[model samples]
Target: MKGRGFIFAFLPLLLTTCIDPFDIGDVVNGQPRLVVDGLLTNQPQAHEVRISYSSPTLNTFDREVVSGADVFIEDENGSQVSLIEDTEREGVYLTPSNFAGTVGVTYTLRVRTAENVSYRSLPEMMRPVAEIDSIYAELDSRQSLSSLGTLLNNWGMQFYVSTGTGTPESNFYQWKWEETYQFTAPLAREDQIIQPICYQSGRQFNQLLIGSSQDFSQDRIGRQPITFVSKNTYKLQQRYSLLVKQLSLSERAFNFWSDVEVQRDTDGSLFDPPPSQIIGNMVRDDDPEDIVLGYFQVSAVTEQRFFITRAEVPASPGGPIGGFSSCVESSEPPADGNNGESSGGPDDGPPDFCYDCTLIQGTTTERPSFW
Candidate 1:
């Protein structure tokens, strides 16, 4: 899901439908419309709300962060939790790690932009969700014609997940995942000592997964595909791991995300529906007539993770795809006896964090506590 991009793409259309040519001045002089994407869960963790602007008038649709905005969430009990701006992440406001809402308790989102314009979310109730019974990787074949259009080769692994019986009243569900893997550098330092394998991790940024038991006869869901990872890709070069978080959505939130998922799948297809705007849960309190985009959703999340070793994914005929067959080659030829490359960070450091421990295209050397 190209979250920001879709808002940018459909906004101009939304504006065209709501704005009148006779009132061109309103479109030109009116305050910019705000966009919000927020989610809350029963899990005790730092939650976030992202505030941005829709500049539909711009030549290119770009999200304008609304910084210096006052943001917070209030519970039915009247206790208010303040959210502080995450400076590193523009437009993001984070709640304290101790903050956690309870199931059945309704929460409201409140925001006041630097300009004094205020916004609020319709009260959303937190709901409980079924825990994932299990999550695992299936080394399914991902074959396609090669560049020469002559042969088809094995590609990647498709992940499958399952959940226990869900509550009848709270059957709607959505998924979010983070992926981590280990990779060794192709070339090392002048010292010529082999570098240890380093681990890197990253969260899936945009592929939205939403489902429900509304149409199913059973209360549980099983063997549903969650995602796929190409074999021999950097992520599959060594060991691989995945953590999936399942969140239970309210009816309103489900409908909103369902629309987004459908539109995403049908994008560019011949049967795709005409472009349309997705009206989210946020709106202009200053002016009811303003057209706003995006959603502020609340859910109860249950998460689980699984590890897939490099060997677990069957090695293809070409071995692990691209190079790495002989990383020892070095900048020049190794001194004959050492056919492999001798590489380490030019400077000294653990093989995991040669330069930085925190960043490696989402990989980190600090092993996950669960790992």
Candidate 2:
């Protein structure tokens, strides 16, 4: 089966089977509806796993707890690891220790319920993928807007992520990126500009996955040059994290009612069936940590630009308006393939680059950082 763009598209087919008279009432009360939400990518890390269940909605009074369910992880070497419940939380189980899943190792999961129903997942292998080397960000000038007689400038940052592996021709991998920003405003202030942004992309099957860069960009806000009084410097800090995961093509089907077998009485009466066979592809060597762990690699850079009243002012004691700090604290040359040049550096990187300005000795109280 072709991989769907969204994971939720599998819900409809997951709930119903091909059996005729699909009326859910034919099943016994309190039939279990299990949901497994985590699938690990080939990255080596520890990830969280969540399994939940709800009673058949059609049968109202059949609600029951899924407690006492046994969950375990199995590796390719026939090693089994048991999961324990979280002390601070209920109904959630976590691996006893962290495990970094390696490529070429197959993993599977086993779940045994209180009612003696069993479910297993097909063995999944972690596929090798590229890792991001660096990310570059620059101001986006196309999104400026004019409002209330003032040319309010909205700021946008474009990102370019470099990977060490070559692009693949087929077998698309899902990518997720998140950014966290911090403002100079007080921690209690709710109006800060920190927010989370995300984007998704995929690669096709049969394609050669090679080392290269993938472009993913997003506009921060609708408005530009956030209008504000001069002289006040706002500090903006941002950090980014990326996650890539390969999904399996085959899906496992399980019976909602699995424990008890149903039969017809001698008087032509029907007995309530037990939970439909809780069936799913048995995962032979499942590793809970790798399935949920997000391979985390982060890179950060910061710049401060100020708004000023006069375009041509005497050189201030602080520094140039568009200058940037050194990428590394030490004097060691930047790492190869690491493009750490600033807009205005020893060679004068870019002309339009302007750094935030401070209150100069002779300037007025209101000094603009960047226009």
Candidate 3:
């Protein structure tokens, strides 16, 4: 997954509601606000909490990292575990590898900054998440505005998830996904001993994906559309693997993310509702009135992996997309047919990736274990 730059985005939402006059200059020169983003799940892994201060929306500086802070999580049973800060990542703190949140156990996150300003989160209980019964994809199309101000039909794949009902008390859910796809270079050949196959992987960022079974009469979610991949992109060019993680959220957590989604989806139209102050669960012990900016989440997570091949998706009506259109070969091969560089001259040759596939970004020749 990408870095949570969303923390920075949350700043404007808070500033607009908390500050007077709504002046841009005031925010540009205002004090940095503390942000706490942490999550604990049922999976036994080294969970992490990210601590940073929000950078001014108009500032050129990066997000402010609150390093050398003391961070920990305590359970309702009075057991506590200290999190170790990552030396390389500054403000990020990680729990022990064996540490995992158990269902029904309430957990609270605490932080003490280097400045001695302490903050604590309201206790959040880990709730049980439903297992994904199945994952499927189907051909779909969406109309989008073109640069010429005309509607253009963009064809793509829509991925859906069907899951059994969760515990009655835990029906709110959020879904996150990471995708890995396999692609081959256009000019690769076995006889010439070139590594053609490669893989690229990434996760959806910036977008909030959440659903509630309470919205439905059945109290169960079926075929919920978690994400969509447009056929115009390279992701569907070859074999693709998507791993979807489902997390259970409390009603409060669900409402919090829903508000975030509302703010994110607003296109800055006159009819859009003004962004409101999103009060997180954290409160500063040193100053009760300070507004902390992020959420500390506790959830029971379940996951499922789905795979698809190029042949599975029908061809786009507009024609083949995602091909290496830029990888054009010269009429004549290299002088010795070995350098893989243009005959014009090694220094004057086209991009390195035109001849070798591995040089492409986000691609690796090594096959994934799951693949």
Candidate 4:
């Protein structure tokens, strides 16, 4: 960042950076603020709105729960639905399965913490979403160099969604994907397979996609890529299924997400606006200037699901990579000698990490209902 090649004063003019106004170190000096995250959807069954508190600019995921509060949502018709805290989950408030928002209706959330602090969201009208015309998969391949300096061949499938939007007012949309795949792990004891099958499901993370049709002429997003799977990984080794949720966002919600996209894309240069705190419709009723992080909105959602098997990618020039993860299986007995081994007492077995696939985050032995 130094030297004569680029002027020091012009550094901000070249490229922008993505950092909140406060450095991470300021977290200890800053006051904790409320983080409101969730949405009211038309298809909602026991919908949840999470309330937690955390100061900004820290690299920690620990957020204190704002619990023991009265939470409820009021519809434009003046009907109020109370939310009860989930005894099983901290900071999560849930509504009845029958409680679902309706399209074209505005809803506002109100919360009064046990500490007597009150916060509310501006009434957000439930927007309308375009239905997905179709979802298709395309087998693709690419080459790259591995860290081991070897040529790598990768194959995968790219999933896309098609939409038909003839209306002009419905110009903003958001997308999120949930993928579940079956992984079979062969657990062996002493050379013979003890558990030949282990089924686990996983959900995709950080697959963010947003589109605004304001610029295009009447035509909505035709073919938008949702997610891709690299064949080199174990995800595509067996059967895989994906769920795509298309959400209709109000112009305000669209703009909020757009700013998030911009801040994520910038490098803190003059070309980009200086990084500032991004807050949504949630505000404190007690203090007007108090900054609350996160947003609450009502959205109409349409979802589509796609299923694919290894046989679908026929052109890929390789055999299936079984989902078995590489790990050191010891023939020795456990240090505690309490583990139930075979009659001989000391049989070779896979480690708990590999044997119990649930060790992986977000994995469950209970298969998804759709699968």
Candidate 5:
């Protein structure tokens, strides 16, 4: 036989060139992914759940603080609940301080990872929408929290919902706004209190302005406007509870924040000069007049479009009338009206107040009252 067919074609090419140290790099390693975002709205007693991850190296060692992972919750006759890990804020996974999620029940989420890596989330069903047609307060002189300071005081609150009718397009609606402030006393120290300023995304009517007035170019105020009603006016409040879930597609984790290095004094002559602190977690305040500084927490998901009619008062372009009385005339000045003349007054020389109005180019040197 031709030497047994050349030993069966050289023994299958020597067993395919024998090499399997567990398939070496199995095509270049890198396999460990999981990201699950959870949200249930109707706002009131909204529980908590925030998980984050994604890393291959921004500096390596990516976030995995599931606080001892392994979380579970299932109900629909299977009855089960297990969720814990939120000691101040670690990887947030809390739910069971008197469990609340009953609108017809259907929930599931089991996650386990200590490197064992096993993640799942599939069943989330509960829908009951409609409740909240009253919560109003007005005195909004076009809203302001500190364009410079002092303008109608600052106040915001408007939430109205009295509508129902879905399944006409696979129904997917979400709205959550909760405000609970009960502090008559207890806080003269321990600063950092900026809660529930605003957050609206009732399915893409995007708006988030929490902690207003560090002056990114001031416009701050208790801004409000979220409307959509047509469920025969209103009536759905036995405490109100509407939950509908079934949306989880995890795996896209990459949270990076580290890019800040500002030091400016092109030549406005340092009046105090001392601001170059960039210690990560997302900090940026080279102080043009003050721009976004530390304290990280940002979330986004949008479709955008929210409408409400009625509030259109415009018709006053008539001629002059002098002596202030075009209806109690007043239309400008007051945003700190030039903040103490740019904070250096004692007759500071060479300050015709425009050394290019405080040059700041490279290392963010504060300038721009309107620069």
Candidate 6:
């Protein structure tokens, strides 16, 4: 019994070790790396380049903004445009509102930071992407571990896109998407004290989605999987909208994105390749040996938006999804439910968010134009 108890006591620690194999603390060590992400596309709009330092190792999601940088985008023909720092958003520099990239024209990005460290990217030609054919989704099931550590199957939708036939010059591609969905409260009041319905928006980022047609017999992209939405959440509870943007990438840019994808997907296991920084095209002006993180991409862009209504998905065995299981009313009503007043009143409701949807992050009472 004593030996069995000891083994059980250590089992949780062992499980935790297996679940998180990488020791990020030892690898990141709070060292700040310069990260620059810049893009110029064929669409006529205000282009942007973000300059910042990677968050301290311990806080990888938080960025240290690099401000007061002299940023510019120039073409091979000697034409140049200075990017002005957005006073509203630090570390972000923007081009003129009417500026746009021309297909077949080579572009380069240059930046000089407040510290006077200069960096530049190798010029890359903008390639034109074919128009997207169609965007669709399929009902599917995904396996996830429940809080009890048991594997559970969750229903969801897997999204795919078919793009134009690929030619040797147009084989490399990249995609990015954002989603907005409508959800409502479980309970409704006759009088509209607050908005019972709300819309939430989010983007799928940090995950590189790219494709190549060179290896296939038919030089076209068909049913290329772009993203997925699980019914485990309120996203698929009502109407959902997804906007996908397709970009044509140069071979060099494709290769850089491939390296980034590999590094992002890598797990520090014995069988996995050792982790290393995936270098981009940017190089330090004075010190070639110094590393600069992130990429500068110039591409032609095409985009489409698709919507999914709850009616399309199969009915859940447990009936319609409630706003949130935790959003239940308290046994005792508060005084003034308006603005979470706890004074005892017949209208008072428990769980503040159930009374007002805006309390939730990324939620808005205003209906989106697309909706």
Highest lDDT scorer: 3
* CA lDDT scores, all candidates in order: 0.64, 0.32, 0.71, 0.65, 0.28, 0.70
Better of 1 and 4 by lDDT: 4
Error of 1 at 333 (Å): 18
On lDDT, the stronger of 1 and 5 is 1
Candidates 2 and 6: which is better by lDDT? 6
TM-score-based ranking, best first? 3, 6, 4, 1, 2, 5
The weakest ten consecutive residues by lDDT in model 2 span 292-301
**Tens-digit lDDT string for candidate 5 (1-371):** 11000000101000000010000001112432233334432232324544444232332244343456766666678887676777787766766665666664566655565655555444555544322223332222234455666654222223332222222321222232322111111112235352211111112112211121122232222222332211111111001112112111111111111111112212335664543322212211232221111211112222221222222111122111111111122221112111111223335422212222111111123322222
**Model 3 off-target regions past 4 Å?**
1-31, 56-62, 145-149, 166-170, 188-191, 266-273, 316-318, 328-355
Q: Over 4 Å off in model 6, which ranges?
A: 1-33, 53-64, 114-117, 166-170, 190-195, 270-272, 316-323, 328-352, 355-359
Candidate 6 clashing pairs? 334-345, 335-343, 335-344, 335-345
Q: How many backbone clashes does candidate 4 have?
A: 6
Model 2 ranges with Cα > 4 A deviation: 1-32, 40-46, 55-65, 138-155, 158-164, 167-171, 186-371
Q: Show the colliding residue pairs in model 4.
A: 12-270, 16-267, 16-268, 16-269, 17-267, 17-268
Candidate 3 residue-wise lDDT, 1-371, digit = tens: 11111211222232221001011121323556787888899888888888777666646244677899999999999899999998788878999989999999999999999888899998999988888889999888889899999999888888998875644532777777888888765564446675578787887654456777664455467777867787766677789899999888887888776666556557888999864446667889878888777778899999999999989988857556544443443423322111223334434545456556566655678899999
Query: Model 2, 229: alpha-carbon shift in Å?
Result: 22
Instruction: Report lDDT (Cα) of residue 2, candidate 5.
Output: 10
Q: Candidate 1 lDDT, tens digit per residue, 108-193? A: 99999999988888889987788899998876666678788876755678897888475554377777778777766554557756
Query: TM-score of each candidate?
Result: 0.74, 0.41, 0.81, 0.75, 0.24, 0.78
Winner of 2 and 3 under lDDT: 3
In terms of lDDT, model 6 sits at 0.70
Candidate 5: the clashing residue pairs are 54-253, 124-245, 126-243, 126-244, 127-243, 204-304, 263-363
RMSD versus native structure for model 5: 27.1
